[model samples]
Target: MPQKTNLNYWIDYWNRTNPASDLMDEESLVSFWDKRSEDFADKIATAGGRKRSRENIALLEASGFCAEGARVLDIGCGAGSLSLPLARAGAEVTSFDISPGMLAQVQRVADREGLSVTTIAGSWWTANIDRLGFREKFDLVISSMTPAIKDAETLERMITCSRASCFYIGSFPGGRDAILSDLLSRIGKIPSPRRPPMGFLFPFMYLYLKGYRPEVTFSRRRWNETLDTKKAAAHAIDIISHDQTVTPAMNRAIQRYYKETAVDGKCIFKNEMFLGMMVWKVRP
Candidate 1:
């Protein structure tokens, strides 16, 4: 029988074999996110509070990621989508994002909810962790749906910032479903290229290279969301398109889907379930 591959060994091997990724710099990434912040905020805040944002928080809690009076750091915390929930759960959350605009929205929500959260606007790569004024620093470092260390230097930096555990949730290669592919095809646009599996494997490998055996967990969630009006359906389409090119045929197809799938003027759309893996270990 073939030997079962140790997850950490595979991770390290993949990282060493893969070429460097050309991910955008922090400024460019933040700019892209800033431009879409409002749409994301609307979708998340109005998605009935049980979707990706909430699911991420639930997963963290289930994993024992944070505790009462513990300090948590939410990197790339877009508009407090995840930070607010952590704060409400009794952790002292420091929400950091590269975009000031994104941080502004997070602050507004935190202020309105009477939640005490400290917001930092800077690239995690360059942020002075010492200036944050936390005595003992974070027990949990969490980043949801953000780039998980595009380069080796950033990877080391992320590890350096975490006091106990670091959790990174990102899309897996070949994880897209037929539904999303169909939607993309209707618009005559090629699906975004898949990231090399090494993107995920490397982090796990890094831990092994450092002589730690990390605990890894994988999970997925699937569901359909209903948009109750043509406007809502259009908004959904726009969100997916990112205000980029949407051919007329694609628009018609969306309209047809809206008409056919909708009930009582509500449109139903399905998103492919995303699979995420969490790799963690106690501080060495």
Candidate 2:
């Protein structure tokens, strides 16, 4: 038997760790995000989110991928975190998301700002570069903290669509999620089968082994939010359902918990997350 190359090894590791079945099917995933699109748009427009977007935009500008007339493709661009900024920076921005609801957020903002951003609705998992006329057509290709870029094929498609540059962001190993745990606990006997997907480790290693010198940055931060009981209930259900089935009773239980426990119709949410990002020139 032949020894596996490091690239293959990492790809295999990613596959074994984050299997497709563990993720929501396309329809469920789409519906889940669609329901939360309004909340997501609001979150990504916050001061902290703007700051983060600026940081990402700065990275692209510093790397010479974000500039006047540059063609940029932002995959899984939730509420135009980077796309809007890139458009403002004078790049030709194309924002793609699996959920039409999410894309609507981008378009709304773009219209308000008088910025031009083309919106595409499709799942990256099934996107065909050739048919989409995307092969080597973009100056920069990027995805931030999205399950869309799951494995070798998805990663390769980013490169296939890009002339040179790419940026990717993924989760780190551990963080605080008391809010999530508490939400599931409200669902009585239904447990949160929360498994942290093997994150940037395998993909980063895979890129490195393929002879790409990727510049990586790690970020850790804590965020807090207060939402109405009803919205909080919806949020919790969407999150819990992503990893495991949330029965109708479980959903009602979550809602009831919020309704009864909320003070002045509001519930508090807190989370601390660690994330990693990488930028590289795929064809340089």
Candidate 3:
């Protein structure tokens, strides 16, 4: 369990923030790729495939969300990270996103692989559900590292549309193991208020409120990367300089941390974190 004090505070703060803020908007979401997309795309395209892809697929399978001849809806499916793999596994997939650039990329991948997928270009929050004609038409609805309908109304909308199950991915707030916190603290900046583990909490609370017992699983992945320390430091500098809250002094401090942490011209960076997934059947 996460610290209640910090978790609640963050959740409250996030709730008060604009639900449709740029962070949640499609354009803002894709803008995250502006700096690293080309490099990242090459890395991903060349890495053969991500190891995390298999892990995610396994998690979904264990939860009874198999891809064998089932229909799956991936909201906020950026560049077909999961969608492509699912399609290859023989599932009919519909991926929706807010960025035309991302959708274009997804199309290119699908076309290259000769895989057919329905692509929707729209904001998840404002998408016309009726226009899609997919109400209660999917076996699984998934949102990875993206916000789920936070409030009850949106939750109901998502549930009503999910025929069998829904899966949400959210960060665990205020965990001592948060990688983002470590990165920020190196710059003498206080971490942002921790938000509720909506990915885990939303489905749990939704099931609880509806008189059902949901099965919950907590999981974590440690990503270790070997990067040339000098290059890594430069990249970190670029990232912090662009952040809204980082100051010049803070940036220098972070640079120093990166310098000190480097070993033998390379650094092995590790991200320790927690996440949860919940699943429950909708009563007939």
lDDT (10s digit) by residue, model 3, range 196-259: 1245565455456466665566777555566675566555655444335566676667667666
Best-performing candidate as measured by TM-score: 2
Off by over 4 Å in 1: 1-21, 46-48, 51-66, 128-136, 177-180, 187-199, 225-268
Cα TM-score per model: 0.69, 0.91, 0.72
Give candidate 1's TM-score. Answer: 0.69
lDDT of 2 by residue, 54-172 (tens): 88777776776646888999999878888898888888989989999999999999999988699999999999889988999998898888878888888899888988899988888
For candidate 1, the C-alpha RMSD (Å) to the true structure equals 5.5
Clashing pairs in 1: 12-205
Clashes of 3: 1
Q: In model 2, where is the ten-residue run with the lowest total lDDT?
A: 190-199
Instruction: Score candidate 3 by TM-score against the native.
Output: 0.72
Report per-prediction Cα RMSD to one decimal.
5.5, 2.5, 5.7
How many backbone overlaps does candidate 2 show? 0
Compare the candidates by lDDT and give the number of the best one. 2
Candidate 1 vs 2: which has more TM-score: 2
| Clash pairs, model 3 backbone | 10-194
* Evaluation by lDDT, superior candidate among 2 and 3: 2
